[model samples]
Target chain A: MDFGDSPEESEFRLRLRGWLQGNNPGLPTSSTDDDYWKGAAAWHRSLFGAGFFGMSWPTAIGGQGLPSVYDVIVDEELAASGAPPRPSLGYLVQGILEHGNEDIQARFLPGIISGRERWCQGFSEPDAGSDLASLRTRADRQGDDYVITGHKVWTSYSDDAEWCLVLARTDQEVAKHRGISAFVVPMHQPGIEQRPLRMINGMTKEFGEVAFNEARVPAVNMIGGPGEGWRLAMTIVSHEREPGELGYVARYTKVVNELTRRVRVNPSGFREDQVRDLGWAIVEVEMLRLHVRRRLSDRLNGISHGPEGSVDKLLMTWTEQSLGHAALSIGGIAHGGGDDTALNTYLYSRAQSVMGGTSQIQRNLVAGRILGLPSS
Target chain B: MDVRLSTEQQALRESVARVVDQLAPHAVGEIGNAERTSKLDAAVASSGWRELRLGDDQGDPLATGVEAGIIAEEFGRGLADVSFLGPTMAAELRRLAGAAQSESAETVAFTSDLSSIAIAADGQLSSFVAIDASGCSRALLLAARSDGNFLAEVDVASDEVGLDLTRPSSTLGSPASLEPSGRSISDDDLMRWTALGLSLTCADLVGIMQGAVQLSTDYASQRRQYGAPIGSFQAMQHMLADAFVMMEGSRSVTLHAAWAVDALHPRDAVGAASVAKAYCARAARDVCETAIQVHGGIGNTWECLAHVYLRRALLSSDIFGGAGNSLDRVLQHYGIGA
Candidate 1:
């Protein structure tokens, strides 16, 4: 069992590290600002331009076709260099690459990879949060297009997206899961209304509620055939849960490092519990880091994960929440220190267990599917 | 990096498992079966697992830390009543100090806190603890002289059985004297040795978690309540699943820590092992408790194996220091402490 990088991996890591030294656009501390989002997008474009993004995707999609370890290296180096996180669109990319036909891939993947065309996921509805299969979004068949009418809550980057991946019920006669279908709809269409939601952290534009009223999407944009959206959604969510593929471990490490720096700067300012909280955060984050490395190692060894992504998601949730609590405690935000950055971070951490998949649902999956526990 | 075990390592794990299955105690009543204990002891001694860290001509270990960790984990899984951790640590001390391998079985003595090796001065070994000393006569110590810290051997005095039924520990006893072995060690050597110790303990904790969860899972599958298997309930299933997740995470970190012992620098190796130790030590306790909880009424009984796993977890968790001490090491490594 070797934990050190392979020779090729080591060389690639070195070259990437050198590139990051020159190209890293240091992230702003807060995400609430419009400039932060603009900077993140710009940084994403720069990373794509420099060939540091999409290291694991096939060359047909403008990727280097390198192994996943290269992506792992990119994540570590970016975090180590204090750069903003790579844009998290791997799930969308994978959904299209796996289910979309040749033309759709040729049309959407390059723009997605190059950050030329931004995208947002239209998955959750107000009533269908964890129970996503019960979504009432309808996509009725037309001549050459499907008219989609649905309400999608928690649509991240909806206001900024050029395209949105929508899951709507194409046939109400079949089972709920089988009746669904996936579509790539333009965000600029006339029938789509995107109203930004004010996040608890006071971020207005990071999340939006998009209402599609008979929005027209060409039938060719349908990913796979009808009744494929459930499978596509499942694939997309599984990818979303993977910290290794999404570079979340690095992002958590960055947060923890920031917390560590704060504590270091004012060592006497924090209480004992706060210090211990920092310690817990550090340990949990480090565990996730090592855990992701091991997962990557398993991938290199040709081990495919199934419900294991649920485990990863759960661990990531723990790490983020703990780090968030620690950040709040150390920053003393609850006591009116009024540090917006730490408060924003702490508020954002609450969503980890809810977004992608709830911790409860994840436990159910692990228990029912992975552990073979009989469900009542 | 490839974290999967090689074919030889897998074979080693299987053989160790076979030995444990054949001779290790299967029930609380069988713990003191002298004939079975002797056979297991002989098997372990012949296996040379204790000498896995003994130095070659070039002073490198006979086997890497991953191989030694595999044996430790398997022993932990079976609750094997024979000594492995102590003797392997003794061999590591000897290897680090450039001493010849011992012909007889030996273990290592730690300070009362089990945070470090017991230090000796002027032939007087103070209050100390000998861990994993089930069949050992002598234990290794670090004798601090004006020149440097040298390797020393001390008698076990008497076996003092501890909470862990599988492994016996002798504590709060002064050995006859500290016998200098005429081999000195450096701070870096000690750090590297501690790295191995932490990695082994973490590996052991992972094993304990795996065993505890499997025991609970099997029990839940069979033990019916409310006219159905208790495992059918979401509460019980979620607990076991959570425990399984902890075990898996512990296993992952422990594997890296074990690999880092030989693959990374001494300081870096200690850092990695500390990370694994902190995670596994914390997770092992919760997992064992979850196991006991899953067994319901039977879990509290002394005859049941759930408590045994907890006992073993308690010992391993505190051997090289618990979660708090490990986090201190991690925080110190990160240069982030008051």
Candidate 2:
């Protein structure tokens, strides 16, 4: 409803910003702006081990136990400085909590909090990507355990992930959307296979695909009930619009500022005509930032982010792509000659509209849920 | 940010949606009959559905985007023809230009067969072609000079003949010669209003193209060739995928433009809206064409519903400058002659 950071939030933001200002491992001379994650992959763990990462988590679980927005502010500033990712998986454990059993949390929560255990999502099967509910993976019940068998693609954090939270249809008799269960899967279990999905982006550090065959796990691994898998999945998906955590605006700020500076190039460099959109690209980026930030801030203040997230997700990708497009404009043909820069951005942006949920699906939700229209 | 509408706005979308539901004849099968085919007269006539006409007393702007988004969705699903562009957008224009303008323009119709009039060299009225100019209301004239300040409105009877029949049209007042109202709109206001128009149109485009995709996706899933679903074909899949991507881009740009209209400089907002409109128009065309193309030879038949989207797409492009025009405008805004 308002843009001002609250007294507590401002205090939190100031503290976080102050810490980031002094402690920031600014982009390395050799490391590009985006390489913060790829370059400082291990340093990221140490940084999170300090109080700067996962702010609101319980102190017993390696956090300061402040409000979740405390983390949001940290991210906002970190993103402003284009810092490498700190522990990005605080709430990701909630997926485990909802899907993982109590034993799983007791063992892993400490490490996750202390930035030791990194978990990746393994719901996407090679064949069952968007048709996630219809995943074909099989986990046959074995004595005192189950043997997992399946291929999972787009397992975004599998490369260095210590564990994975997986969604598999435990029962197939029920329809596609129902009759499934979730498990806190161990990544290093015998028969587990992981391979980096060579992305259009040249590097692959965290995001990769995972496959499993006869991977053994204990019976106590299940989080919620056996047949309520879709509900669990819904919880994860719905949280996308839950506000604050999605740090898109923070990321966008860096892009926008960089864009403004790079917008007009010198003939010695790049000129205004050299760029296709110029000021408009910056405007689009700001529009996307405000669009998401307004909703996220409102949600942080306790307003539920609703059909508006559709507005956010949609704009996020557009602005991301626009930023990428503007980057290409500034960089020109020579900057990212091959699959390096603009092309990578163009391809990644293509997935933004495709991934999470397709833009069409968002409209369907807006029409049916928000606008109260009948199903098409 | 905060895309949730106030409860009041929600109610307005509901009300307009209900009215559209009631007035719907062709899509609902009421006017689908031969006898009622031309009964658009009873449907859109000034007296028949004055609410839809959008007079000064019509209502608020809620129905334009959010509500109209719903209406356009269903209208696309039903593949109905409502001439929404002329009636709804024209109404918004009236609200924007104001009631005083419409009424004063009406008075000029009386006592003269004035096709159009002007403030002359000395700032006075001028003549026009005479017709059955007799038996008209009292005539009056006003100053309408200067650019972006005023528009001269000359009224015409419904019975008047015109080209292009989906909806009525009239030669607008002397856009160039009208006297100035001496009012200067903030550039932000100008941008905001134009954004409103473009955003609403983008919303409508989303609805229609969604219908087009639905038409194609559904048809492909059901219609069989070579004993398999056409939806399974890689070519169709690629087409649908691209359509999905372009449509997503359109949707994103629309929301972005809407936010800009709500909160940015009006002069600059045209760029954002231009992006949305240009993207939307192009998507509408691509989606509709592919929808029909995927439907194959059977789709070309009028018996099928695909052409409705095709026609609608054609109409949408022209509404706020075609794709090419908007693209030029967007590029020109950047000082890039492209």
Candidate 3:
């Protein structure tokens, strides 16, 4: 029930705020993918050095050994201070920590923690967008290596990642889920190719299509043995939907404030309906903040991530879309003509429901898994 | 921060649920039956549920809110015909205004417009409608005035059937004198009262939605369609799931509002309450409608329980103004006009 921060949390927040104020890494100005990744890597290294990276990981694994709330504090501070997004290694680290064996953990944990390596997910394919288990990616066993051949679409950061956590089919005799296995494959091998996907916004080269033609990886790099890919993938998706991890409430607050300011400053003034719509949007953002805080409170109370994450995801989707819609209607029409940032944001909001898990899939998950409804 | 209820609160919820469950079926059966109103009123009063939110326990507002919400939720879930809210809130307001509690059940009638006053002169009062005033002889008028809040007490002249069968309405004629309470209610206290009222209403809406969803889910499991149970179809499951999500959202916001009512500042509590009411007012209606849609023909019938939920939801949605008015309140909190 307590919404305010504890004394210790306040102190941590103050310290993080101070560090961000002094060591903010400005956004990259380069258009080239190489420079963009290099800048992101440098920023990640800076955060790691400043003890802001991997704050919730155990000290034995090169983390700060702080509570998960500290990570939330860092996210809030980073978002509020307009700092460039830190490298997205939380999911990769979670996968390795939860599912990886001792050897695999020892091999990947430090690299991910130290920001010395980058990883991309290789789950979605052309035919297996929502039905991810039906992926046709194949990994045949060899003498000492598994040769992987598949095409991964929408593999974000794959063009720059040094490694990929891939899901490949190993045993065709079993069910679709059981036939799959997870592996850590080197991305720079001879048979691997990455081509950046052109976004509708005509900017940002983060997403790419990665094709692997007999890409070789040592058999020892397999995570959680064979037939455990589905479980591992679920873990990864859960981490991706981790409540309050992205500081979305803070960012949305900023957007709402800016939108309100724009509406107030408009020459024509807000009509009655516009004002009501603005009010609705504002309330939605506040609801999102409350919702996220509740989920975080549950996390602190030892509640594990479950299908409730889908609930938060659904709310986040609605909030972001509402905010974007409001901004465009208010700022776009009021200000008149080409506001690229606003337009870009509206377009990007469309992906929120599609990316992690489509809204339809999320609803299905909530119904089937959470509600125990029968699946037909 | 922990949002989970404490052990004591959990026990309180369980007790309230137990009592309401025991009395609900009978009370729901007595809806639209004037003869049973007094009996139901006596049963609820004997249970001492009205005193839970009267600030009797060390004057802790948070405890009162959480406890009231628990009771209100049970009442909504059971569709119990107990007129607890009006009496409980009137008592709280009287306490805040330093007035003595009325001997009989007191119902508070709220009006947003300050100009629509019921004149009381020469022992005859003007007529004004009081919503959800079943089993209450006295009515407390709560309205917003230009300078501050207006609070007065009057006598109910006649009872009438309302859209919500469970909560019978009454019309209050002008009293012998328009006697305002001696104590003036500050804006802060008014906000606190409004927050409590909205939180309780949200709790009721949450219960109604939860009840409807449970009914639909049970029917979906048993009702056959296309040679199988309808619940097995994705259409039914998704509909029910969406309803479940709305219910959870309403529940979450309402709980937060309830907590904020006692824990946060009055202004913050108002903000939270408005958000909670707006969300629940809209979401509960949607959930109830979805429940009916999932149930199909049976849901449309009078024998089915879906309409009962819808009726209650419709009444509760407009209790403190509908979602639009709640949103307007939110905007006013931000110093925005209209």
Candidate 4:
């Protein structure tokens, strides 16, 4: 029941804190800007250069072979020091490490870990979002390459990524989930095109619509055997849902801390309900922090989780929305004051329930898988 | 950091769950069943859970707050018709004040608003309510002074079968005689004790949510509608899933609060407990209400166990103050608001 860090964890945290003191890349003005993401990539490279990035991955790759808690500490210190977020490549790394063959691993993981290559996931199409297994993407086998043709929406970082981990149908006669395969398709091929989408938060480069017109990938680039795409996709989504592994707790904490500072700087300006909202926001963020730590504790104790990742996703959604509302209310609802970060924060939070998996879908997974409820 | 329970703590939880299963009231009518109540009381007495916070040789508690919280949570889950929260809180105060432990059964008295512990003055206790007062002869209070607060005790005036039927509370009918325990309590001691109280209530709220969700989930699986179990409906499933998520979040936060009570500084422990209380207090009500909604018409009736959970949740929510008060505590700690 001890919640204090171990000697090793504490030491790592302290050292990371000291490192961040000098190496901090101050937070960008707007996440929607191209410069923000460009700075983000540079920050990722800097952290990697400092031996602070990817510490949880195996040493066989580019990581330091430390416990996952070190990643959490790096995230916590980065946020606490107002640094740009660590590059969210954990899910991509996990997908490749779990499903990629030794050849694929040896070729891609080092570049990904070292931030030499950027990657985006190509799973959700316009027609296959919640029902991702029904994706229309196709990869036809050729002599030495599989030419892919698909449309991927909400493909984050696609505009800048050099590689896209894509899911495409390899067989037409089998079940929807069984017909699919995963590939590490190069993003800059002649047949590939990326158009950045403007989010409600006015973020364009953050999410893009990528179109694959006979994009060629070598046969060796396939992540897993045919019909293994579903498993790989599931691994990626589940890993993505873990706030602890993804360092999302620190991200939310950063937002809540800013809101608290605003309210403290001018305490009487806010209404009671708005103040209450801020307090609730603080509570939700703390809940996420403790929840992630508890999940980490479970991992430390060798407890493997499956659909329970849905629980983490739902909690993260609630916390993000709560923090967003707190920001909006405290920042004032009326617009046009030369400051739209609060509105942007709220707008971005709306994606929490929509992206990764819709809240409804996540709930259905929790019910059917974790609670053993009957499917209708 | 590790939040997993130790082997002994796990064993303690299992034992408490067994006791609750064996003797806890299973229905509303069984709440006052003398046979079951007395047996439950006897089991609780022998279990020494209420004495968990009693001072050891060095005036530290016999068991940490996490152990006490585990017992509290299990009891809350089964709606065990006995006293644990009140007696344990009294023992905690005694330990903090370095006073000798009471021999007979005792409980703690809270203010009329149920926000803070009651303060006795001039050998008379004012408008106060003693919660978890079942089978208790006296309630403990504090005597305020310039130097520090001291421990005091008063007779339980009368029992009031309040909104929560499982556990009875007592209100002072007259000024109960206050007797000084002769040990002073420091501000740090009180803050730490408050942290423990907040944590136990949060743990109880977690248990109540768990019990409510389990009851609703079971019913949803069995109750048929439109030629299928109601649980098969997406609406009902989502409701139950949301409730389950809230319950797990509460459990995670509460575990940290319970651990922080003994591990951190007094003020920091209270801060952590306040965070847990705010989260658990808000989530418990929602989860309990969702449980009622899941059961449809039966949930509205008194016989259904869903309302019992809601009632218990209401009491635990208000014990250290509800969501609003907890938020204020947190805000105050941060010096963020007037």
Q: Which candidate number has the best DockQ?
A: 4
Question: TM-score for each prediction?
Answer: 0.96, 0.64, 0.90, 0.98
Output DockQ, candidate 1. Answer: 0.70
What does candidate 1's lDDT look like per residue over A193-231, in tens digits? 999998788878688999999999999999999999998
TM-score of chain B of each: 0.97, 0.65, 0.89, 0.97
DockQ (0 to 1) for model 3: 0.53
Residue A158 in candidate 2, Cα distance off native in Å: 3.9
Give candidate 4 misplaced runs (Cα > 4 Å): A29-33, A303-305, B173-177
Global lDDT of each model?
0.86, 0.55, 0.76, 0.87
Q: Distance (Å) between predicted and true CA of B66, model 3?
A: 2.4
Candidate 4 lDDT tens digits, A117-141: 9889999999999999999999999
Name the 10 consecutive residues with the lowest summed lDDT in model 2 chain A: A28-37
Can you write out model 2's per-residue Cα lDDT over A60-132, one digit (the tens) per residue? Answer: 6566766554555665676667664354453465555556566766787777766566678777787886667
Report DockQ per prediction, comma-separated.
0.70, 0.06, 0.53, 0.84
lDDT (tens digit, per residue) of candidate 4 on B12-66: 9999999999999888878889998999999989878889999999988999999
Q: Per-residue lDDT of B60-150 in model 3, one digit per residue for the tens? A: 4324687788888888887877687777677677766766657877777654221122323333433455666777788887444445555
Per-residue lDDT tens digits for candidate 3, residues A1-376, read 5666789889888988899888986663221223455577788889898888887788878899766656556756776676755566677788788899999998888987897887788999999998999999999999999999999998988877898999999999998999999999999989899998877656556788999999999999999988998999988887676446555665566666766766666625777777677787787877777776677666656636578877777878878888778766665532455545666556667888898888888888888887777777
Among incorrect, acceptable, medium and high, the docking class of model 3 is medium
Lowest summed lDDT window (length 10), candidate 4 chain B: B172-181
